[model samples]
Each structure stands twice: as C-alpha cells, then as structure tokens.
Target: MKSEYKANSITLAGAIAMGTGVMIGAGIFALTGQIAQLAGPLFPLSFIAGALVTAFSAYTYVKMSNAYPSAGGIAMILQKAYGPTTIAAAAALLMALSMVINESLVARTFATYLLEGMGLKRTGWAVPALGVGLIVFSYFINAAGNRSVGLFSIVMAILKVGGIALFGAAALWAGGVSFEAATDGQSTQIGGFVASVALSILAFKGFTTITNSGAEVTDPNRNVGRAIIASIGICVIVYLLVAFAVGSSLTLEEIIAAKDYALAEAAGPTLGRTGFYLTVLLAIVATSSGLIASIFAVSRMLAMLTDMKLIPHSHFGMKGAIRDHTLIYTVVIAGFLTVFFDLSRIASLGAFFYLVMDIIIHWGVFRHLRHEIGAAGAVLVTAITLDIVVLSAFAVLKWQSDPLIVVISLVLMAAVFAFERFYLRHLRDGDAHHDSHAKT
Candidate 1:
C-alpha cells in the first residue's frame, strides 16, 4: 500500500475551495427546505445560530491543528486527548461515518434535483441510479490525484458560488425584497427549531474536512485554520441569502412541500422555469464538486485511521496505495447509502453521528487537552454545551416525528463503540504508537 500523506499537495486556495466546495455543495442545496420544515418561518436564523455554534466548535480544532498539523487531524486530536483507546477510535470513526453519510445525502440531493429539472417523476429507480452514478463519477475525479481534485474544486467552487449567489439575489429582488417570513403565523415547536440547528450544523461540518487534509495543505499550521474559518464565513453568507430567498419566494408550507427540491421550486416562482432549470443545473454542479472534495477527505481520513492503526486495513488486492483502496471504500459505502436511505433519513443519521462525535471532541479538548493544546476552556465548554442541547433536542424531535431513524442512529453508535472496544483489546493495552506521546 502507498504511504498515507503527501505533504504540501494542497495549497491554501485549494484548501479553501475544497472546504467551501463541500460546505455550500451539501449545505444550501441539501438542507434548506429540511431546516425550513423544522424551524418554521424563522428557519433562516437557524443558519446563523448554527454558524455561531460552529464557530465555537471550530476553536478546539483550530488550536489543535495549529499546534500539531497532521493528515490524521480529528483522530490525532482525539488520540492526544484520550490516548489510543476505544473512545478515540470510535469518535473518529463517527466523524468519518458522518461525512460518508453526508456524501449520500448530497448524492441523493443531486439526483432529486436532476429528476425535477428533467421533468421526470420524483420517485422510482432513476433517482438512486443517478445518485450512484455521480458517486462513481466523483471517485474517478478523486482517483486522478491531488492536483486534479484541487483544480477541479477551485473552478467548480467559483462557478457554483457565483451562480448560487445570483440565484438568491435575483429571487429576493423579484419577490420584492421582504421579510414576510418573520410575520408568519405558524407556531413551530421550539425543540424542533433547536433540532433544526443540528442539520444546519451538518451543513457547516465540512470545515472538519479541512483538518483531515491539514498535512497535505501548504503551510498546514496556518492554512488549515484559515481555510476552515473562510469556508464557514462564506457558507454563512450564502446560506442566509438563499434561506431568505426561499422564504421570500415561497411560504413556509410551500418550502416544506417541495422540501427535497426547494431551490428549484423557489426559482420557478420568481425566476421563471428557466431559472428553475438553472438552479437545478447549479445544484448538480455544487453536489458533484462537493462529492469529489468530500471523497478526497473521507478517503484520507480512513487511510489515516489505518495508518494510525485506529482501524483495520486490508489491501484487498488494490494495486496502488492504502488511499487508493480507501477511496473505493468511501464511494462504495456512499453509493450504498444513496440507494438504501432516503434523503431525510440520511440527513438525520448524519446529524446524530456528527453531533455525538463533536461532543466527544469538545469534551476531550476541555477535560484533557486544553492546557496542552492552548484551547480555551470556555469555548470548549460552550461547544460541548451547544452540541448536547442541539443533539438532545434533535433526539426528542425525531422520537416524536420519526422514531425509527432515532432508534437506528442510537443502535449504530452503540455498535461502533462495542466494536472499537473489542478491536482495541488486541492492541496490547491499546497504546497505539501514534498515541504514546499523547496526553490523557
């Protein structure tokens, strides 16, 4: 198998492009209508709230990255704080799995919009078939290596970001620039609104992808943090603009009605049928780029886990490298999820896995790595507090709305922990060489 990391393969611009590529790709297109459904008319604010919460969560990662930039990233941070134990491996796996879930969510979103634009029926095999095809397409792009991925991400990010911004601005202007959503008579459950932040957080969680690629980024220590912040900053603006655009063009009920293809639906009202198609086209570009960038990071994260011995690795007769094998693994799982799970379940599962893993990361930094990593205790504490509140709200809301997904998420997490506990037992006290220099 090939070595894990190739330092300086990604430059700062490429890093930011990849970061925003994943964020806006999955964030605005995939979650807007879903967030609207849960947060009611004021769902736009959930993006702001999610951003604020994410900024807090980012503090721990930024500090850790600056001090010790590595390809392993989140796993590295977990190991530093908790050692080579089950919790560390499990949490890192959670993060990786959550990202994989995001990939399927994005793939399905692409399929959903493509079908809508093609004037095809919203149901049947076409959606999943197309989604899986895109996942395969992305694997080829990623397999082209870092330069191809980086250049493609940068170009696509520019096109999609510009196109999406124009869509939002035009929709708002055509709809007569109004905050009518704020005067909505609808009364949504506060727990549901708070729960919406979980999805919004999922939107912003692409920032973690930057950390996973930190070792490959030029000027890793500085650029990784900068890229994370820049990506979030761009996404916050884009999400708010799009949220208001959708709110202005469509009523709360209308957005929820067309929740799967909210942007296309919104475009039809103000920008005409042509605009609707354009938005659909843009969504395809956004999701395609998002998957490519996401696949790059997820494969690397899994490869890093293998290199760290946090997870088992097998060549499986893959000719090139560990990363080569992991790339196939990432897309295959994403495609399976794309086929098996619907969009809502995929999003819900992602939110649960990600929030739980995030909470563990914050706790580790706060309880053990703060002094060593120079992370502020207050920020870490606030991050943990927010994650718990959002996660709890999400769980209760899911139980009330769709109990099956909640049960599935809980069971999967428990299963991961149990598997890790058993796997690490064979590691001779679980003191992975990667964690011997680590603290707690």
Candidate 2:
C-alpha cells in the first residue's frame, strides 16, 4: 500500500533532483580534497574522468530499466538475471548495505561541516552525536512520505546547486588563486590518477539511487534512464567547477590539510568569514537532502527484498508496511556506522561495496540477460572491465593505506552471502514441509 502510495508521484525533475542530491551530497563537499591529494593540480580532470567512467556504469542500469522498470531496481535486475538465486539476493543485500553506508557518510559530512561552521572542535562524541542527529532528522522527514522526499529533494537540490555556483563565482572573483600550483608542471603517476578515479567514481555513484527508486518515478520506464544521465551531467559540471574553485584558492597542501572541510576552508580565503558560512550552509543543505533521498530509496529497496522473500522481515510491532520496518532498520545501521567510523573509512567502505556490487550487476546483465535487456555486450564488458581495474587498484591502495576497513568490507560481503545461503536452505525445507502436508 505504501508502495502504491509512491507510484507515479515523482516527476522527471524530481527524479533528477533525487539523483543529483545524492551524488553531489555524497561527493563534492567531502571528497574534493581527498581527490586533490591523489590527482594533484589535475584534480578537476579526475572528476571529468570519473564522469566518463560513471557513464559507462550507468549504461547497464539504463538499459535494464528501459527493458524492465521496477521499484526493486538492482534487486529486480538481479532476480531477472539470476532468477531469485543466492547470487541475486546476496548482491541485492550488498547494494542495500552500501546505500546504508552512504547515508552514514553523508551524515558525518553534515556533522563535520556544521561543526566547522560553528567554529567548534570535532572530538569525542560530538561529531557522531551531530551525525546521528542529522540521520534522525532525515529519518523523520523520510517517514513522512515519498512526496515529501521528492519535494524536499528538489528544493535542496536547487539551493545547493545555486550555493555551489555562488561559491565558485565569488572565489574566482577574489583572484589570488594560482592555477600554476594546481598543475605545478609535475609528472603525476598513472597509478595515482587511476586511484583518484576510483574514489572519484564514488562521488558519482549516487546516480544509482535513481535506479533504486525507479518504481516510484512517474514514467519510470523512460525517465529512470533519463534521470540517471541528467543527474550525472549536472553533477559532473558542478564537481568540476567546485574542484577548480577549491584548487585555485588553496595549495595542494592546504587542501589536504583541511581535506575533511576543504570546501569551507576554500571559502575562508576568497569570501572571508561570510563565504565560509555560506559554503558550510551549502554542505548542510546538500548532505541533509542526500540523507533524506538515500533513506527513502534504500528503505523501499529493502522492503522490496522482503516482499520477494529474498530477505526476512519483521514488523517489530510497527503499524505500517514493510517499508516502515526497513526504514527503522536502515537508520539504525547507518547511525551505528556513523558513530563508529570516521569520514575516510565510511567513504572507503561505501566505494568498495558499491564497486563490487556494480561489477556483479554488470556481469549479470552481460552474461545472463543481455539479449533480453537489449544491452550491448561490448558496453557491458567495458563497464565490468573498468570496474575491476579501478576496484582492484582501489583495494590495493586501501590495503596499504588503511587495511582495517578493507577487512571489514570483505567480511561483511562474505557474511551477506553466508546468510543468504542459510535463508535459502530454510526456504527449501519449508516448501518440502508444505508439500508433505498437502499430500497428507
């Protein structure tokens, strides 16, 4: 019934706003400095490269949606390709978990910038407390309804996009930024560029949230693909401008030094205290909107999984549909993640899980259902190949730089499959019992 409530409510612009809100919220504010660290003065180029890679990844989801648009999004694709098997269920679960991880990342980003704007130090429970508060706020807003989510996304998307443009324009007018330092005429390593691309890919990964909400969008069959493409285009341009503004205003060292709050830091030089407040306000808007849209999408996805019997569900004495339970579950998990992990680890974990799940989706489309979905074999192969190369590079880098999160990602992925296997066994046993009872 709640699913029915959302049907045909989201317009094309709303869909684009949802996708843009998620991608921009997740990436630009938090990742500009981290990307600059890896890509040097050419950090903007990393976003360009990332946009290209994201297009390739988007191709499969778009093609699949064109053929079979469902609210199930990734899970629906997996079931279509693999026929409700363990692989489909596991990959779907992985996607759901990655989305939850993304929510935590956005929430933390909100806390970080909010504290920076307030001129408060980030220490002990303060950051997580603020992060959890944001998540809680988003949860309440999301629980209101899909229409509320869509309208909020549009408003925030407009405000944040405008805010970013103003930040860039005002900073450029300040005129002290050195593009020479951005390039510095240094020969950067191809590996470092590739690693940055991998992270940059994470920044645009929010586009998939559109696909997750496919069933809710008006004219989803056609609009889902369009929304995905439009969201990516809008975000790519915004990210490039922001990257340049940050790069020009701050030295590579400065960017890295304040990587957690680079956008706000960039404001300090150009717009003075007023600009700093504005940039921080923009971050709050983006991250808050992102958390709202993400919670809406992921809750629907988990509810779909439960409805399909791929995942078990319990009401826990709640009143509404399965989505209500899933919403609570999603927020609880994300809150725990926010409280425990810092920004970098939260981001790395999200990227790792998403890339792996993305590879799985591409493989499913290419190997099992290419003909049915009207997907190009060549495009799917290219997408899968690039995901593997970048994901491998990212993994190696993470293994060296911060191995603990890598371990957590692998262990969690393994646990998803293991749990699915046991669930499948139970399903088979229950069916056998029903068959015996009918015979009797």
Candidate 3:
C-alpha cells in the first residue's frame, strides 16, 4: 500500500502565495491590452467583476476544503460527496484538458517574449522548443517535491508584482493621472462590457489552484480559505492600478495596434529600454511559473483519481523508470499542442473546461448543503447563478463566432466519460477473473 501523505508543512503565507503567484501571470501582461481594446477604460471594472465572481466560487471551494482537508481538494470532495465514477470522469476531463490548453497558451506567450528578447523572428519551432524545455524542467522540479516548487513560485511572484508596481510608478511619474483621458471615446455598451468581463476573468483563473491542492496545504480549512481571499484581493488591486497606468500612458488606438504583448511595448515609453527588457523577462518568469503551477495542481488531481480506483492504480505511483517517463510524455504532449494551436483557441478551450468544472463544483456544494440556510446558501446560490450566466454568455458568443470549437470541446468531454466507463469495467472484470481462479 502507498503511504499516506501529511499536510502540516505548508504555511498560510505559502498558500496565499500559491494562488497569488498562479493568478498574477502572463495573462495580465498580455491579455490586458486585448481586453482594453474590447471594453476600453471599463476594462478595470470588468476585471473587478470577474474577481467578484471568482470570490464567490472561491468561497464554495473554501467551504468544501474545510469540510474535507484531504490531499485531493475539490476532486476528493466530489468523489466523497457524489462517488468515484462521477468524479473520475469529471476531474480527469477537466484537469487534463484545462492544463493542456493553459500550457499551450503560456508557452506561446513565452516564445514571443524569447524571440523579442533575442532579436530573432518568431518561427514555427521556437515555441515548441521553448514550451517543451520549460515543461520538462518544471516536471523535474515538481517531481523533486512541492516545497522547492513553492519556494520558486514565491520568488517569481515577488518579481512579477514588483515589476508591475514599478511600471505603475513610472506611469505616474510620466503624468499618467488623467482618468478622463483614459475613458474618452471608449465603448459604454452594457452587453459588450459584460462580454469583456468574461475575457478578463481568464486573468484570475489561477486562484483555484490553491483549492485544488488543499490536501498539500497546512491547516487547509483556515489557510486555504484565507489564501484564496488574499490572493484575489491582491490581484484585483494590482490589476486595476496597472490597467489605470497603461490606459493613462497610451491611447486606445495605440493599445489596439500594439496587440501582442502590448504592456511591454507601452512600458518602453515611460520606463525606457532597460525597463522594457525587465517587463519581458517578468513575462517569461510569470508564464513559466503559471505553467509549472498548473502542472503541479493537475498532476495531483490525476494522482487522486488513480488512488480512488477511478482509473488504473498503475497510473498513480512513481515506479522505477516510469516516473520520469510520465513526466516526459506530458511535456511532449503539451509542447505539441502549444506549437500547433492559436492563443485564442487555447484560451477558449481552457475557459470551457474550467467553467464546466466550476459549475459542477458549485452544484456539488449546494447539493451537499441543501439543508443550510442564510449566508452559506446565499453564497452557493449566487455562485451557481453567476457561473451559469457567465458560462452561457461565453458559450453563446463562441457558438456564433466559432461553433466548431464549441462542438469539439463537448465531444471531447463526452469521449472522456466513455473512456472512464470502459476502463473501470475492464478493471472490475480482471479482478473477478483473479478471484475465481484463486477459488478454483
């Protein structure tokens, strides 16, 4: 039997840093300009709205994690509340699909920065090579243990946060206090603003990684919950301030024209060439850290599913050479996907899986606490409603613009369910055969 793991080492600060580090990454640096183009000055407001939705969802997760301070977090809670088979299908599909998409997106962004830094043109091979290399490195670091990865994340988060703060200060020094100028001539359409909020929400997606690794955190109930709130709060403030600085520094037309990695380009005007390089370096570190964190969280989910017998136990333990082999395989798969897919496609796919999982998590919480009233019930109901609204809106938009992607996502999810059913049946049948032979 595998030895049971303990979770008394991770501190509250470490837990909060996990979420903060994961949430405040390449998305803020890259996606901010894109979202600003969509919602103009209201981009900051959209981010705030997204944070609100995430907070509600985080509340449910905190409650669930508190109830069950085990290693699996939400996956384990679902398995206990619903059962193994349901969780196996849902958790596997959600974690695998989301992590792959996230890895691809982060890799593509990292490659762009690397090419810019080296004065080399972006090529077909650049992203794949960089993506594969980073993933492999991250796998080894994680396989070493969680503490090393956690410490590395803390240092990277500090650099990213400090870099953004310095940028904001530079903007202020350059007379960037004109709020009216930032919002001038921007779209005020309510529907468009809501749609933009959905895009902005992607920037805040990493906070849930804390809840996902609840089993690893020390005093999960208290620490994880506190961490979730602190991480989201910090990201929201930093994002708003940075967005304000960027908006004040550049015009709408300039922002739209500076599409890919606009933040770094904008920073050059205020912070000069050296500051621009620093921003690019921060982008690389932020994306790399986020990708590494995703791998850690998703691998835990996979291990949990295997341990619960939802999948083959063979997939769980790190045995002999197979341990390193699995890491290499994962890196290769993620790299291949990144080298092939576009950023929008990757983001949309990631959002689809995460949104569905969020809905399921909310449902599980509500169902488990059906008898509860007042604040807990209110939180559950609000989270479910918000998730449905946001997810439905995103689905509608995607369907009208890109129906094929939406269809493919649903089909892939269904296939995962079928695979789980088939595998479990095979395992049961093999066990029965061994038992009958022993009796004979």
Candidate 4:
C-alpha cells in the first residue's frame, strides 16, 4: 500500500525540466496568436507582464513548500490554511481541474500543429480525435513511472527549448526585426490587454507542477524553491524570444488570423518550408512533453486529495494504486474536453479556473498561514490584488466576447463548492450517528 504512494526522487534538473516541459508546451506553441488577438501589436510584452505577476504568485507557493513540502502541493497549502473544510477541498479541486484543462489545451495544440504539417486545419472532428490520441499516448509513457517521465521531460525540454530558441533567432535575423504589428494600426483597449494577461499567466503557471511534486524532488526544501525560480526565469526568456519571433515574422492581423497555428505560419514565410516543418516538429515535442508532465502531476494531486479525504474516491473495481485510478480519470476528462471544446474555449476555461483558485490560495495564506510560513504579508496581498484585477478583466472580456464560457465557468465552480460542502456535512452526520449508537 505504501509503495503505491512512493515516487522516485527527481534531481533539480529533472524538476526544472518537468516545470518547463509543462510551461512551454501550452504557453508558446498554442497561445502566441491568442495573446496577439487581445494584446494587439505589443503582444510580446504580455509575456513579460505575465511573468512579473507570476513571480509574485510564486512567492506564496515557494514559502509554503520551503516551510513544509509535501506530495499534494497546492492541496497542502489549502488544507494548512483552511483546515479540513469545504473551502480547502473545493479550491484544491479547482486547481486539479485547471491542470486537467491545461492537458487538453496543449493536447489540442498538438493536434492543431500536426494538422498544419498535413496541410490540414483544426476545423473538423479530426482535431479532437488527434488530441485524444496524444492524450492516450502520454498515459502509457507516464504509466512507466517518474523515472520515465523525468527522463522523457529532460530530453524533450532540451529539444523543444533549443529548437524554439533557434527558430526565434532565425526568424528575427531573416525578418530584419520588423515591428509591423504596431505600425499596422490595429490596437486593443486597456481591458483587452489586461485580459490577455490572464492567458499569459496560464503560460507560466507550470511552476505549480514543481510545487506539486515537491515530495519527489531530492532536497525538497531548497531544490523545490530553486526549481520554481529557475523554471520561471528560463520560461520568461524563452517565451519572450518566441513572442518577438512571431511578432517580427507576422503582422497582428496575420497572427490572430492563424491564431491556432501561428508559430507554424510564422515559420513558413520567414524560415521557408524546412524551417516550417521543423517548427511543427518542435511543437509536437513541446506539447506532448507538456501533456506528459501535466498528467503526471495532476494525477498525483488528485490521489493526494483522495488520501486526505478532501474529495471522494472509489477504485471502481480496477486499480493498482489510488494514483492509477486517478490517472485514468484525469485523461478521460481531458479527452472529453478535447473532443468537445475548441482550443480557445479550453484556454479560457483553464484561465478562469486557475485565477479563481490562485486568489483563494493567496487569501488563505494571508489570513492564516503567513506567520507560520514566515511569508511577508505585503507579497501575499500583492498576489491577491493582481489575481483579482486579472480575473476581473478576463471575466469582463469573456462576458463580452464569449459569454457562454463565462456562464459555464461560474456554474461549474459554484457546483463544485456545493458538492464539496454536502459531502463534508454528510461525513460529519455519519460520524455523529455512529458516536451516539456507540454511547447507547
């Protein structure tokens, strides 16, 4: 039973690989055009803004992990702050679900880019079918355990990061560093720009992948924090390079028009067919590795939640470990999203869920755990303030642009809390009934 919960120790490099694997997968490959749509000509700058905000948000997780690292990264933080209650459970569930959403987002991006190579676009049932296939492939790779995931992540991270940076440099050189997006006269409002930050934050949120696997890292206390900072720093550099590459290679309209496969589009005109195909290959590696790392971390988080009794769990009559069952659950739900929602809707839902959970985390630490964790109140408060602002902007934009998703997000979140509250109360009543009978 204990062996089922056991995780192989990951070195600092492996941890960083895992973090960047998840970050780069969805961030750069699929999100560049989407960011451009909202941020307009200065879309490259949005990654920087997102990184700055993410740095503040990372402070809370770093402090918490340094003080008390555990397997259930975000879950531990929520429970420590709020106790065994509905708020903690519901918030933890939100984080877990958001990670699952990300898996689908990147998987769909994989499908989108792959279709580009085939001279096909993401307009039909084939997109989600391919996305679901990738998710299944990742599940097998992960079933081999942490060593497989870590080594695969390190190798894939090296390939994609180096490949992406190379593409960026080459595009800048060939395109003569044009700033066409700005001069083209297309612009965005402040709200639009702010809303784009939400997507950008999603790009960098892979750092939580590190915090979630703290128990698996060697030197969990120090290396966990180090990996988080290093991963973020590395992503900021890579994301900026790619953003500028895309901006220089294409106009704002060109970017948003090809939003689903912008990197491939940019590569084709600037780098020629070979470079274009190479970029497609890199997208495959990035999104697939990202999906692998994401599924690995998210399943672990769900298993942790079940162990803590924060969420209900049943083996459903087939499982080697709690994690084994959770892994299936993670992929099934992710595959469903891939099948139903398009990339844009998937990204939007993930952003909303993540920002809401992030606020809950910051607030929990500020109200209760700061003193025990030795975190600065100002930093925690800043994270909360920033999240609120971004989430508000995103909500308004979604309400205006795609109101259906906004309503769906609100309903889902409310329903999760309601479910959690009822489950906890039922457990209490069951225990009380047992107690009275025993006394009688």
Candidate 5:
C-alpha cells in the first residue's frame, strides 16, 4: 500500500503563533492573584524566573529540532534518543492526557468569565457547555488542517497579547506601577522564592508546543529554533510588564479575594467597568485560542504517531463511516473529561507532563550531541539542571499538600513506559517475521 503521509508547511510566523498562543493564555489573567498570594510582592520576579527556565528548555528544543528537523518534533527527538516505540507510547499518552485536561480547564475558565460578564446568576451548566462547545469547535478547526489553525492562532495571539498590554498599561496609568510591591511582602527565604518561581513557570509551559509539529514547519531546523527563542523572549517581557502592573495596581489581599475573574477585578479598579468587560472578553478569546492550539498540536502528534506505526493505523486512516465514528468517539471522550475536572488540577497535571518531556529532550541533546556542544549547550545544560532542581522542590511542596496526586502521576507515567516496552517487543517480532518471509 502507498503511504498517505502529508508534509507539514508551517512558516516561522505560524510556529511563533503556536508557541506564544500556548504560553499566553487564561493563566496570565488568573494566576496573578494566586501567585501574588504565594510570593507576595515578588511575583514579578517569579514571572521572570519562570521565563528564564522556559528559555532554557526552549534552547534545547531549538538545537534538537535544528539537528533532526523531523515533523514529529519532540517525538522524533525521543525516537532518536530512546526509539520509536518509546517515542510513540510516551508522546501519545503525555500529549493526549495533558491536552484533554488543559482543554477542559481553558473551556471552564472561558465559560466562567463569559457568564460573569453577562451577569448570569447561575453558571453551573454554562461552564461545562461552553467547554464542550469550545472543544468541538477546536477539534473541527484542527481537522481542517494546520494552516487554518495556525492563521487563527496568530490572530488570537495578537489579541491576547494586546489585551494584556492594554490591561497592564491602564493599570499602570491608574497609579499601579511599582516593582517594589511584587516581592515586598513575600518570604525572602531562598527555598520559598524558588518554589514560588516554579509555580510561576507553569504559566509559561505552552511555548514548547512549537517543536511538537516539527514535520509540518516550513523550515524546521531554522524556523523552529528561531521561533522558540523569539517567542520566549517576547513572553518574558510581556509577563514581567503585566505582573508589574497587576501587582502595583491592587493590594495582594484584593487580588487574592477575587474569585471568578482576577484580571477583570484588577482592571476594574483601574479601567472601571469598561476595562473589566474588556479583560473578560480577552480571557474568553485567549482561552479559546489555547483550546484550538492544543487540539491542533495533539491531533498532529496523533498523525505523527500513526505514521511511525506507534499507534494503530486505523487511528490515522479513518475514512467515511470510520472517520465519522472516530470523530464522535474522540469528542465524547475529550468532552466528558473536560466537563468533570477543575482547571487548576488539569493545569498542574499538564505542567508535570511538560516538565518530564523537557527533561527527556534535554537528556537527548546531552546524550547524542556531545560533540556539537557550544556556549549555548552549556547554558542549556545549566538551565535543565536548574529546572529539574526547581521542579523537584515544587513537587515536594505539592506532595506535602497532596501526595496522592503526585504518586498517581508517577504511577501513570511508569505504566505508560511499561506498555511501550511490551508493544515494542511485539513490533520487533513482527518485523523479524516479515524479513523471514521476504527471504523465502
């Protein structure tokens, strides 16, 4: 049978959109209050620290993509470092599970902001309904193709960044511009600071998605690397400026006190009712954009896995009745989970998976490309080490709060690896049989 693989054609702009859109989402709007409560006045510094950590991981991704430049992005890197079966199973489970949770969180947050804007007295059903609708819409857009989703992402990213900038500037103009307050009241202990910084890093987790579609990018080697660096740089500046504005504009108590819409609440004091409404609208758009990007990336990852024969061919080769039925099944599975979970829990789990992927990619670079080391490699290595240390500390703190969830995540990852090993042995046997038949 002839192969049905289609080449990816993503430009630098589209790649940047994928990275930036994933990084800047409802988290920026909502996390400020919680982070402020945790880090006190040094929340801006936490944002900077998170950006730096992400920049380190992004550097490794860029270097690896430049060297291998395959369409599967991280999966390709994993295959080269680990092998096809490991790449397929780990990548599939990680991306699928994280995206399902991430999409649901974004949808719930979007509905919350939307309902709050319209003064709806009750939003119980609307939240889940909006989440389901967003997922269905995103899945369809992604199914249409990468270009369509990429274009939509670029537009949405612009709006999201613009909304953040406007909100920041307006807050600053209203006498909420002070760097001192961001970390002023927070604990000055190094351990506490690092823990807060790690959580803040969660806010910047989506930038790595650019490499996930390495095969589809127009110039995977050059553009993917360039886009990852450029997006992180831009994200850093935006996060800092926005954090400064939000921290300075309202007291930590006011921010923490806000429940439904923190950014809207912060803006309300500065831009009044108009600013509040605008922030809410921007949140909806940002979250929706994120949902679309997640769906697009995860679907492409599925396609890549199919091409590599990590997943069943039927997954990538649905046609007519099979295709329609598959779509229905995917929507049903994704929708049910999104409706049942809280956004923070989903985000935390997604962050954990991403951290693991980041570590794996870094190890791949260190293992396979030692001869190609340079100043960038040194920096990348340092960043990865620091990231691991930070993540470990954060995990310990989180474990202290909820040991069961952390333990379960570890078990889940281990089970995924075990399944990959079993499937790989079967694949090897099948290949041997095929070779024997050909010889006869």
Candidate 6:
C-alpha cells in the first residue's frame, strides 16, 4: 500500500548522492586513523578489501530490489524470507538501531573536528554537547519533509566530496610524501588486518541506505541497483585516495595519537590554518547531512514496519504519522548514545550489530529466498561466508581489546529478539481476530 501511496520523488542522482553522503560522512575522516592503527602500513588496503566484501554483500540487495522494489525494501525482503514473524521484526530493528548508532558516531565526529579546528580542548562535555545539539537540529530538518532532506543531501554530497578531494590533493602536493612511507616499515599482523577490514566495511556500509529508498526513487528497479553500484564505486576511489593522503602526511603513530581529529590534523602540515578550517567546515557539513539522510531513512523504515503491523505504534500525544514518532525516537536514542560513548566504542558497537544483521540478511536470502529472487545460490553462499568470517574475526579482536562492547552488543541483540517475541505474543489474539474479520 505504501508503494501505491507515495509517488517517486527522488531522481537517480539524488539517490546516489544520499548514499554517498552517508558513506563519506564520519567514515574516512574518523576511521582512517583507527584503521591505520590496526592495519599499520596496509590501512589503505583494508578499505579496498572492505569494498570487495561490500560487493558481495551488495549482491543480495540488488537481486532483491530488482525482484521486489518497495519503500519497505529490506523489511519486505525479510518478511518474504522469514514471514512476518519474530525474525523479521527483530532483524529489521537491528538495522534500524545500527543506523541510529551511526548517527551518534557521526555527530561525535562532527563535534571532535569542530573543537579541534577551533583550537579548543576536546575534554569533558564539549564533544557530547555539540553532538547532541546536531542530533536535535537534524530531527527538526527531517520533520520538515523529504524534499528538503533530498536537496540538502545532494548539495552536501557534492561539497563534501570536493572538499575531501582538495584536502587529499593539496596535502599530497605540499608534503610530497612517498607511497612507501604509507605502505611499508611496519609489522603486519594477519588477525589485526582482518579485523581492521571489518571496521573498513563499516565505512562503506552506507550503500544499503539506498535500498531503503527504493519506493521513493524514480524507476525503483533500475535506479536502486544503479545508485548502489555507483555509490560503492565512487566511495571506493575516494576512500582509497583519502587514506593515502592521510597516511602519506602523518606517520602511523601521529595518526593514532590524533585519531579523533586526523583529517583536520592532516591539514595542519599542508595548508596550515586555512586548510584546517576548510576541512573542519566540510566535516561539519558532511556529518550534518549524513545525520539528516540517516534520520530520513530510519524513520521511514520504522514507519513501514508499523504499517506492516510488524511493530507497535504510539501516537504519544502527536499526530498519527508514524514517521513523527519514529523521528523523535531516533533522535532521543542517538542523543543518549552520543552522550555516553566515545567514537571508537560507538563505531565498534555499530559495526558488530551491522555485520551480524547483514549475516542474517544473507542467510535469509541464501537459504530460503534465493530462488524467488532469481539469485545465484553460489553468490548468496559466498556473501554469507564472507560476512561470517569477517564478523568472527572482528568479534575475536573486540573480545580481546574491548570485551565490554562485545557484551553490550550481544545483550542489546538479545533484548531486541526478546522484546519482539513478547510483543507478538501479547498481540496474537487481537491479530487473529483482525485476520478473521478481514477474511470474512
């Protein structure tokens, strides 16, 4: 019914811009140093490796969207694969929460760079305050409507990419640093490299945001897949270049030391105060736009879930528009996360949840929905295998370094499933009565 209700308003370029905006947000600017610390001189390679894994992960989305295009998107796919049962509800919520986690991650990144550029201290409440303020601002923008979000995404995407390109080029030009410095003279650990690849996978995870916009994109069938492929391709090139520039400019130790503000720091050597200000300006724009786009997608996702009767709804003294309630809920949770966690912890939690959710998606497609979607069994199997391998490696690494985050991720996942089961049980008789009335 939602597919029939709303007209296609997003152009192909708009869709691609939305995806790129989300991917390029906090990822390269924040995670480059983190990845560098883990992968050492091979940090750039981790992004390329992540892109390869993303290609496999994306195959499931392309096949499903081509077969069944809807704004419901992944939620619809999950229902088709596992029925409108607990698995569908829980897995969909996992994705929604993962996006929420990313919002807080981007917000914190915005605050960190903003403070650093101003030559201010990053300690105490400064970071969280700015982060929460941005979340509130994005909520208001999302409440304005889709057209505003789309236009802003397009503008911000262009500006952010150009700014990043300039930073990379100018830094490389000014420093004249060699590739050997960035890619050599370090002890490389296989496990750490694999784990870092998992983090790099998070950097490009924004491509899936396009699938969530299927019902809104013009020519959903063709454009959804096209936008996704184009987004990933463009991001791969951009991420590789930025990683090289950062690595070339700063040693691994320097990068890790200023991991939270690496991009702005990278500017100090090349363009001095002016470039730092410019890079900071772009980061703020990118993170703000990323928050707006993510809020738009996740709010729509939860609304779709409610429409399908997969989740409960609450008017909460507001109008009956599900998007309104979901929008409020998204900002509140993201603000809470931004207040409590640092960037690395938030990212690790998000990556853990997302990889697990992605594994479920691949499993659903491979084991049950592959034939219906006309997907190759081999490709589906390969996708699932890769996700599992990466997820396991990342989990081991997290367990060693930050076992608390791993525990939090597991407990949160369990809570989602448990809550869904209880809610479904509570509504079983009512659902049966509604079903009987409809049939009659």
- lDDT, candidates in the order shown: 0.89, 0.85, 0.72, 0.89, 0.70, 0.86
Count of steric clashes across candidates, in order: 1, 1, 1, 0, 8, 0
Worst 10 residues of 4 by lDDT: 1-10
Model 6 agreement with the true structure over 1-440: per-residue lDDT tens digits:
35433648888998888888889989988898888887887688999999999999999999898778777878988888889789888999999899999999999999998898888999889999999999999999988877788778889899887788778888888877675435556777888888898889999999888888787788998889999999999899888878877877777778888898888887787778898898898888888888888888888888888888888888879874777898899899999999999998998989988888898888998889888878999888888888888888889988999999999999999999999998888789788999999999
In order of appearance, the predictions have TM-scores of 0.94, 0.95, 0.89, 0.96, 0.87, 0.95
Local accuracy of candidate 2 as per-residue lDDT tens digits, 1-440:
34354688778988887788778775888888787777776888999988988899999999988788777788888898888788889999998998899899888899999998998999888989999999999899988887798677888888877788778877877844565336655555677778788789989988887787787788888999999999999888888778888878887788888998999998988889988998898898888888988888888888889988899888878898788889999999999999999988988888888888899989988889998877889999999888888888778878888899899989989999999989988998999999999999
Residue-level lDDT of model 4, residues 1-32, one tens digit each, is 23444454778988888787778777788899
C-alpha lDDT (0 to 100) for residue 261 of candidate 2: 93
Clash pairs, candidate 1, are 2-321
Please list the residue runs of candidate 6 whose C-alpha ends up more than 4 Å from where it truly belongs after superposition. Answer: 1-5, 180-184, 433-440
- Which residue pairs in candidate 4 have backbone atoms (N, alpha carbon, C) closer than 3 angstroms, thus clashing? none
Tens-place lDDT per residue, model 3, 253-274, is 7776664576777677777788
**Which pairs in model 5 have colliding backbones?**
8-216, 41-181, 41-182, 41-183, 41-184, 42-182, 42-183, 71-215
For candidate 1, the TM-score is 0.94
* lDDT-superior candidate, 3 or 4: 4
Point out the higher-scoring one by lDDT: 4 or 5: 4
lDDT of 1 by residue, 165-238 (tens): 89999999899767556566887678888999999998899888888778889988898999999989998988
lDDT of 4: 0.89
> How far in Å is the alpha carbon of 336 misplaced in model 6?
0.5
The full ranking of all candidates by lDDT, starting with the best, is 4, 1, 6, 2, 3, 5
Q: Regarding lDDT, does 1 or 3 come out ahead?
A: 1
Which regions of candidate 1 are displaced past 4 Å?
1-4, 429-440
Q: In model 4, what lDDT does residue 147 have?
A: 79
Give the local distance difference test score of model 6: 0.86
* Residue 289 alpha-carbon offset, candidate 5, angstroms: 2.1
What are the per-residue Cα lDDT tens digits for candidate 5 across 276-317? Answer: 898888888898888877766665555556566665445345
Task: Assess the local accuracy of residue 310 in candidate 2 as a C-alpha lDDT between 0 and 100.
Answer: 92
